[model samples]
Target chain A: MTLRTESRFADPDAAYRLLVEAHRKIDPEHGPALDAALVLLLANHIGDPAVLADAIAVAVKVVSPQRQ
Target chain B: MFQFAYRRSPDQDRSSPPRHDVVVVGAGPVGLTLAIDLAQRGRRVLLLDDADRIGEGSRAICFSKRALEVWDRLGVAAPMLAKGVQWQVGKVFLRDEQVYRFDLLAEPGHKMPAFINLQQYYAEAFLVARAGELPGIDLRWKNKVTAVADRGGHVAVTIDTPDGPYELEASHLVACDGARSPIRAMLGAAFIGETFEDQFLIADVKMRAEFPTERWFWFDPPFHTGQSALLHKQPDDVWRIDLQLGRDADPEVERRPERVRPRIERMLGHGDFEFEWISLYRFQCRRMERFVHGRVIFAGDSAHQVSPFGARGANSGVEDAENLAWKLDLTLSGGNAAALLGSYDAERVQAADDNILNSTRATDFIAPHSEYERMLRNVALGLARGHEVGKRMVNAGRLSQPSLYASPLSTPDHDAWDAGPPPGAHLRDVPLGDGFLTDAFRAAGCRFTVLRDGAGPEVPGAAVIDAAASPLFAARYGTRPGDAYLLRPDGYVAGRFRAAAAGAIPAALHRARGAA
Candidate 1:
């Protein structure tokens, strides 16, 4: 399926799932979450709402206290 | 009223004080440093960070001789040194077998801190306390920057604060917001490079046993699936351990040592240790294609994200700040053309790539995917162990050496880009240059000041920064009568000259003012 377009989602898991999928596509290795967080943060600004929500969902899943 | 701004602007009313000479975007180590450098230079400066507190992560652990020199210039390298453990040697192991080692402080009889393991939080906190002491130096916390606009002659910044959005226009904006710099993105700067597909767990644990405060690398970090764990020391009995996670991994499973303990115990020696904090990390060997976009400039992670394998991520960002700080000080005040800032982009971007390559080489060595590649690494590791120099060379690879670059700002000396003591000679890892420097005494973190014999070279506007080069005295440059090299405020090779080379020193200083 094509990438979906969604904005900030109330459910973090949903938003982050979208993010993790995008990250998997962008970061095949999945080593540096900071980069993923960065991509997700920027994606939130520039990505489709669905994409941003997905990233956020995945980010919430990954980054804890996750203070950059 | 007029206390903050030591000097006022022409556009200012007779009744009003000036805003500031410059407004540093983030109060991380880089931003605090720039504020300190400019403030000490008698310029009005303001520093801001989104977070109220200093760094909290086990980020950038190893500091190069260049970084030590910058610290020396700032005059606090000693106190910070007191806070860190000095290291000159690194041990590399392939899976369960310990294989090779390398010493950045190869030759003896030099003053420089080879590579230091200190938390970024301590460094930033020290800088914060230092900045607080200086008059006209104001650091604002929780100042989340939203947008930046270059208004012809100057740049304007708008921040989303807890109260309301406030606007502050300055001569320039130094964005140290890190890899995902919103300011840089707003200005449409290009960050180029791909993300690596390795997930690692970084845990700062408190260990009871003696794990000799040196960096130990496990080829296939014998923990949690096919991953590796890195063990090194931080001040206060804290040890930094990195464990790679599987592709389809869950953070919950990796955060607690209970799940990861067996894996770590198998790799190192035991897992009976108090855990501090756990973080899951993913590194991208990506960098901003450009460092500066108009009136705004990027520093630290905002500029690039190198794999943490080689300690390049945070250290290189610090280098970005150190390199840009002096130039920003000179240029932000309208002394140099705005074009001076262009070199920040040109030179640092190269350094970023160098950092990526260094991290890539180290990461690939321990965590190769292909059988052929893995076999080749094993052969290299086995072969190197047989010879002393070979062993050191392999060790150097693990310590993140042999990574150097020639940026636009670097004045190619007759000996420029020649093989330095390593597998590579990129900007980030050089022994603070060829002075009589040696061992942990050789500084990889201070603003190295090499005082050559005869008529010393003159570095025009070269500020003799205050430095406390302690415990790492062996790394200081030019301990010998004839040898000498000075590090810039940030920690790249700033200037190198003979005793009589003083005549060329000022020109080099000008060259150091900005990138080529």
Candidate 2:
């Protein structure tokens, strides 16, 4: 099955706010650790390596300086 | 209190020693069980041991259900069960926070529990007591086999007794000596494998506390810093504690009461306990190239060894004895000796490899060898706090289970069955009449058994069990009223068929016995 990029969440803005609020009180040095933890958590939930790799590629393509 | 009587053997003349049908070396749990099983099968067995008494300290504490079943067949399970601690729940902790818990025996209605914790000495004492009751078993203490020579049709062994040294001959010799098997060394066999670098300190302490009967394991905790620790309950108000000591820790200093007491006090919050036994050991995963060498076969730690993390060491050895005993008995009864012994080597080597692989994985996870491994283990433990997937990743110990002997001896299934144990799998115990199916199988001398859904054709020389007696029979067999299963003497399925004739069961039994 293809990876869905459609809006599955009913309210995207509230979900995005909740995701950001989870890291509000973290120290700057621990930011990457928290991000790594969140990535692992979400990857485990997704449960498919192919979809995870595709998601990682798409994120890099959208945010990488060379791609831009 | 365990008491061991020093039974002396009649001195044999130095010129010509007596010959026996089977001579077993080492009177440990494995050797004793094999001797008892063989003698019960009407084989004259001579059991020899270097030590006059049973094992010292609680060397092997965890006995699995398969081991209990084997002991039950040998007529020693009742006393062991009465004196052992039965438990199933194991809790894994990450730095004082519970991460995951497991219940091994989730389903009920089985005779034996998932695991029992008893001292090795108690098991040996019970086995020795049972051995004394058997007629054909000759157990002699302070008799050590110093040399083993495999002649073409027989084996010649040299024994060193307190009186003097003597030479004896037997048709077959079995080595159940410990990891440092003198017979194995005498045979010029090499035990090849890896020896782990880390060491663990095992302390059996006697305390009158009300700790729950469960396995408590920690990756790292406030009481013990930067290492793993495990706590288990045994019989007689004793607790077994294992602390991981890194490669450089001095074993002599770590075993001192002064060093060990503070650690126990920190974990238990009191110093009102006495030390029963303390041992420091490094993990090793190794096995011999072959279990059967001509007429001399090896079992137990003499043949294979694995890390104690999985409780595979003694449990697998007992399985080896159970597997080898019947095959040896049949061979002595004029069956195809070569092919049957060859099957033993093939099956138990596979089991040893499985145990070693599982034990190595558990050891690597518990004591990570590299920084990258440590990082991954920590991440797994950290995520295990809430995530379900991470809980599955934490491997404290896999514990012990019976390994399916997938060998050519098992006849392939002819028809397609939906949901049941496949060929080469152990027979699943189900309620039959007032007892269990395994009880009936054992009552028939554990010979080749023919099980059918209902009575159709008579198979001579095989014990027939009608599956209609138990309600679970139909569900477990996954077949209709006419299907049949031919089982081996060791309770493994040899073959399965649909609408078999009278000769089919006998033919399958011959194939299972490794007849051409």
Candidate 3:
């Protein structure tokens, strides 16, 4: 919520909750693929490649914390 | 000479002059509604119009949920409902093909009533006659406001009666005069706006065949130089038809049936139909630069004039009076300051803007800018039928009667969010159980309702405005479960949040308290 990541949202909301809702439709385990897809889709909307990279890095770090 | 009173306090003798807390300049829908709304609140009111007989012109045939709510508040909606036709579907004709249609019933019911097909004359006549019977209400026809001058603390209005020019004084003045509002122009207020170059012909006709009881528009006239025609069906096989006047077409020529008959035959497929009335209109999308200045306020076509396409022009004006009426009462009764009056412009300007957009959009499609515009609109209408999103978007355009009064000046809430409006700024959902948000506020008799979802944040001043997921409310507003929005006493969505907006309730209260 600190720096703007995307415009898919009217405003940033609890991302985990959105992911949970998006995942509830297809998968239960809350797959990393959906998280990655959401990050890339929102990243593309964020427009600036540098901003996208940063948000993606943060999102990846959040979803795949072992990489941290 | 003017006499002010709290109610229908009877005169002691012939020496006692007639008393009125407010004297409305006209007995049109807005004027009569204003008088009744005030009189119902126990304020003595006298309504006057220059016309000798009751209103006869069926000028505005479309009534919004906002208007219905006002009628309900006056306890007159049930009778109107018995006579009025609730239109739930909209059909558009791109030549022979039915290209665009919106099922208003597709949305669930809420507090709002679905759009009704009733003549403005009927509404005005009903309310005026009914309000006349009410104590402290005197509807004097043939009495016109000749001139008005502000006398410092009070307003002096001159009425040119058949007897003579009688002088009257009141606290405030409202100009609801039609396009040619003498009071607005007399006050030297600028009605800054544009007039559409395109002129059109409108006729009320009686046809033996049954046309669908919804408004139907023709984008491109199938015959004679490519103008368009719009048709609205009434109860007794009466259809109001509007034929667009093309760019090079002479409006003077088509002012009567002789020149217009062929085009009507070409577009509606019958010039043989019986004609009740025929007239030509040049749509002027204009508004007063200021709704309020000094003590005189403008309402109805006097303040803003939009095309008849979406029927928001006069309806919004009704809302203007409704909003101003309550605030006027409060201020006159020492409940609020005159600063609250500024919101009349704030909200009504936005409402006028809304009507302008909807009207221009509809007219733009019907009267295409170019061949490309015509083709694009035709194709969009073609696509609009098959695609649900397109249909919903099209439907959204049809129901575009939003009023934005979320300012610190006149809004109900003491709190306002400077950050900007919430997510549903562009989203329009009809009210539930309450009826159309416009009419519900009107029907509530301008009482503040706290709109909530059973348990939510409670604002100190407002009426609790909650949704019951009520089928009735949803039917008119297209609102769903867990949805709630608070409206102004005049029926504009003051602030709404799905789930909840960060500072909505407080923002509403701040605006309300500031207005109060």
Expressed as tens digits, the lDDT of each residue in B1-516 for candidate 1 is: 011212222322323323455878887777777777677656788777776666576677787766665565566577788888898777777556676665668754434467788887777777777888788687777677788788876787776665656666777778878777878778887777766566778888776767676778765544544456678888888888787774567877777768766655765577677767778876677776677766677788887887776667666766676667767766755545444576666667777776776666566555554443344444444444333322433422334432344544454553332222211122222232343232222233233333333234344554332122322232333232333444454445655544444466666665655523
User: Relative to the unseen true structure, what is the C-alpha lDDT of residue B132 in candidate 2, on a scale of 0 to 100?
Assistant: 89
Instruction: Please give the C-alpha DockQ score of model 1.
Output: 0.01
User: What RMSD does each model have against the real structure?
Assistant: 15.3, 8.3, 13.1
Model 1's i-RMS, to one decimal, reads 21.4
Ranked by lDDT from best down, the candidates are 2, 3, 1
DockQ of each: 0.01, 0.04, 0.02
What lDDT score goes with residue B58 in model 2? 53
Which candidate should be chosen as best, given DockQ against the real structure? 2
- Which residue pairs in candidate 2 have backbone atoms (N, alpha carbon, C) closer than 3 angstroms, thus clashing? none
Candidate 3 residue runs with Cα over 4 Å from true position: A1-68, B1-20, B223-225, B266-272, B369-400, B409-446, B451-488, B491-516
Residue-by-residue lDDT tens digits, candidate 2, B1-516: 554555556546646766788999999989999999898888889999888777677599999988998888777998999999999999999877898899988855567788999999989889989998998998888888888777887888888877778888989999999999999999899999988889999999999989799999999888888899999999989999999988899999998989999998998899999999998999999999999998999999999999988899999999999899989998998989888999999999999998997787788788876554566567656646655546777789888988877887887776778866778787777788788777777787777888888876777777887777787887887867788888777788888877644357678887888899
lDDT of each: 0.60, 0.84, 0.62
* Chain B TM-score against the true chain B, each candidate: 0.78, 0.97, 0.80
* Model 1 chain B: lowest-lDDT 10 consecutive positions: B1-10
Ranking of all predicted structures according to TM-score, beginning with the best and ending with the worst? 2, 3, 1
Better of 1 and 2 by lDDT: 2
Please tell me which model should have the higher TM-score, number 1 or number 3.
3
